[model samples]
Target chain A: MDKNLEKKVINYGEAIYEATYQEMQRDNNVFAYGLGADDPKGHYGTTKDLHLKFGKNRCFDTPLSEDGMTGVGIGAAMAGLRPIFIHQRMDFLLLCMNQIVNMASKMRYISSGEHCVPLVIRVAIGRSWGQGAQHSQALQSFFMHIPGLKVIAPTTPHDAKGGLIASIRDNNPVIYIEHRMLYKNAGYVPTNSFEIEIGKGRVLKDGNDITIVGVSHTVEDSLRASELLKSVGVNAEVIDPISLSPIDYEIIRNSVMKTKKLLVVDNGWTRCGFSSEIITDVAINCEKITCERLGFADCPCPTTPSLEKHFYPNPSSIAKLANRMCGGNIDWSPPEVVQHEILSFKGPF
Target chain B: MKNQFDIKKAYYLFLLIRKSEEKIIELYNSDKIKSPVHLSIGQEAIAVGVSLALSKSDIIFSNYRGHAHFIAREANLDKMWAELYGKSRGTARGKGGSMHLNDISKNFMPTSAIVTSAIPEAVGYAFALKYKKKNSVVICYHGEGATDEGVFWESLNFASLHDLPIIFICENNRYAIYSHQNTRSINDPIVSRAISFGIDAERISGNSTEEFFKATIRCKEKIKNNSKPQLLECMTSRWQDHVGVTQPELSKEEENNIKKAIKHDDLKNLENKLSKDEVLHIKKRVNKEIEHAIKFAEASDFPRSSELLENVYY
Candidate 1:
């Protein structure tokens, strides 16, 4: 194994920081601001040494007013500065909802092409260490719902640097979601500046049996699940759609055609989630596929270590689902889901 | 071109807003303007005074009562009327109605019904201008009610701290909807509140367009010379209701005092100052302008429903 691949096993937060730091160095317009970016005690140490290198003006701390600071970033973006705005947690991004959705996302449309807002907002998604409800929400799906936004969720360190580079160069606003769990997980990232094109999905493995599609940290989980299935004599293909919006459905559809079976692993809510979108797309495109399954439960992630084990899907869950779709549980009858109709109408007669 | 006043041009601007507001009220009631309108009939001086003092590069964030904004900025009266009529030629492509009328070419960003929402954004704009070392200013126009929003204070602190070029124009029109200014805050003089923050502030008669010019001139000079933010609280009054049709029932004494305070019928006063023939000629010219605007709006086409998604992702 190469020495570069050796560093790929580090934390995901470090990977995001490396990507941000590299992008800032590559582009003069790229800047980062949040709490602890300036202080030696960086929030996740992703911004460590940034203030020392770039000066406080370029990489500085904000006054805990997320709403005000976010608006400042939006304003700076409008003024021809491409700012990589960092929020410590994804949940805290809620504090600047108006700025993110109303101001940053809609400023270009509001200006009727008179102004272009190029902003990359980096947020840490986590269910980390009992921070519980306030700090555990993953909101990439919420940003994807907005029309003028591009969402990037990169699992590998290489893709992290590449996505950050692409986002900084894009004219429109991009929401870069960095999972806290993948910070130290390094990979073979290039030493120089380059862009990994956005809106393209990567096929990690090739097979003719079943397809497993996942995003962000869940991509790694899906790969592990595919390996477990392989040990049990099932060849499962895996794909990582780095860009959530403008998703490459053709790749998924092509893979599903060969496999005739699909499984989507999402780390977000089961209802109206990214997983739901993938499943619905596959159902429509590949109607005769042997089986389809979504691997997210309908509930908020739990805080306790043991309960969180049940909360998030593991390789075993993915493997079990893949096996079920392969008709491994032939003797067991599937539960019958009864359909119900309830209608209440109020009309002027 | 320098720091000088054009009194005649300034008077013309004031006349423009006053006449525009009068026309808006007539159209609003007559069903020509489908949307509810907020007329700044009595507060013409604030918009005219501030706009005249500003350069074309200087931006403005107007509130709901923005007819004065359109007229003061000398925006096309036809486009202004077309906007109110929901025609495709409107300032916001007819997507934004009365409250959201935005003309970016004139440097007036879209107005929001949410009070003080644009306050922090204005500060952000000023911050960018300052950071880029550009001689630009953002005139954030809000009402006394906006003071209640926490962003108002947040923006004030950020603007003053950074010494950004922002002119916080608080048009104190006595009432923010149903709530009176006194009911909201204990300070009778909000300008003094600005002084506490080390911001140069003044409390002036917002009704008098001339006073607004003087105040805004002083503010622009300060913003340019020192890059510090300033506050000008115009003690203005609205001639109509908060929104749509106004039924502001003033007593006989109140009406008499208000009439004397703002001198609503300035034509009558000008008639006393000039000849009756001159006043009639001015009225005749204004009527012609209004008629031209009406014809333009009538001829303009309404926006197609397909255009709803055209600019959402520009």
Candidate 2:
């Protein structure tokens, strides 16, 4: 990597902040609000300088009432304005499920396209620092289940900037889930306003072996695991599904056809998640392909680090799982596998 | 703007709503409509009174029992009935049945089935109206049962904190589903709760559409000067069940109270404001209109399978 060239790149959080800043400047109708939005930490730096840049009227903090505040956002959207409502943790989104699941998603259909609710709900998924069950829940799968709502979990800095701008511009309610750990991971991102199309997926690395599909943080791990598996006599293709609802299954199916194997990973529970969606698509399109799913255990997220280690999927653990499917030797240690934090987040939120 | 207060005209609107709801109850067993219907039969005056105060440019968000508001806002009766009939000609294109009826062109929002959900939504619309420097005001109407929901308090606090141009209209019919509010709610009345949030609030008789209309007009004036949220608690009664087209199972005393209330209902009182000839003329006109609306709904075609995904997104 060229050191001087690398200086132009930004991380996931910076991309998100820049996307919001640019979109607000582009359209006066776009405003953002939520709890901790105006706090000094600024929603883990994803919303840094937004309040100062846009003024208090545009970027502001809200009360702790999730259900009420979410409904407020919905109301604002209905009134010929675009709103970006943020939830610091995806876990707290459970408190406002009625508003999110029922009202926001059904606004357009119920109004016969008379009301176009252009709104975006940004929630931080995945975690670090023992946030426990209350602070750690990946709700992308849940949002994907909803019909009218669009769900996107952008993993890289470029996708963060492009995907968010797309969601802000999209004329429907979009649930934007960002994995907390991917915020610190740096990647190439343009400074100008751009959009990655909704219901589109990007292939990170192409290989002849089994395809590894991932969402949010799992995509980063899949990318790292693919590189490790290549070192061993196994080559794995890695795909990052940016959109969960209105998913682009064609990308995964195309990859699986060439690879003849699949491994699906998600930040949410393995039982009936986006992984299942991928597996079902493969089962329909492709024939006789071996596949496996990897995700968190089906229970509340544990607090202790030792238990937390078992809770999350790292590159090493994913590579180990991949090797079993592709008939490769298990390498307990790989210098390429990241041993440090992928999220680059330090928090007390 | 002191417009002519037409007693016969007001009764005509109320009769249209009453008969429309009655038609829904009669046709509900016919199995033409799939979704549940929440009728606001005797409580039409509250919505008619308050909504008549609003301009077509203004917006309204309402709860489950929204037929009265739908009619009060002057949404096409044929479309509303067609929506219940699951026809593409419906206001919401048959996507929303009784509870979710909306006319976007009329600036009436699709009603939320969840209680207290639309309260914050109205506040948000108020926030947008103020932000855009528009003169429009947003009003939210919900049943008394919604007052117990935490979102109701939160929305009031949010509205007052920002001084948004909104009004919250609560119809205290005293029952949430089957439970009477007197048995289930807090000792502090809802008006006091609104005042606690720094919102100006008042409690008045919902049986009088003229009184309710006057109060809402005054509230709109206050909101016009300084954008802020206000609350109005209307003492009303629902003659029907919480949902569906059947009569509610009430105690003998409760049933008697309803019967007595209906004897002096807004329509009966409102009739006294007009002559016997004028009242008969209005009733005849309203009945003809209701019959036309029924014929229109019955003739409208159900949605084709191709429309299953229409308007799911913009």
Q: In candidate 2, what are the lDDT values of residues B145-224, reduced to their tens digit?
A: 98888888999898999998888898989988889887887666789878988998989874799988888997888897
- Which ranges of candidate 1 are over 4 A from the true structure? A1-28, A289-300, A330-349, B29-34, B182-189, B192-198, B248-289, B304-306
Give the TM-score, chain B only, in order for the candidates. Answer: 0.91, 0.95
Give one digit per residue, the lDDT tens place, for model 1 in A43-106: 6687888888876667887677777777777767766788878876899988888877877777
DockQ, every prediction: 0.37, 0.83
Best by lDDT: 2
Task: Tell me the whole-model lDDT of each prediction, alpha carbons only.
Answer: 0.74, 0.85
True contacts kept of 1: 0.38
Q: Top model by TM-score, which number?
A: 2
Cα lDDT over the full model 2: 0.85
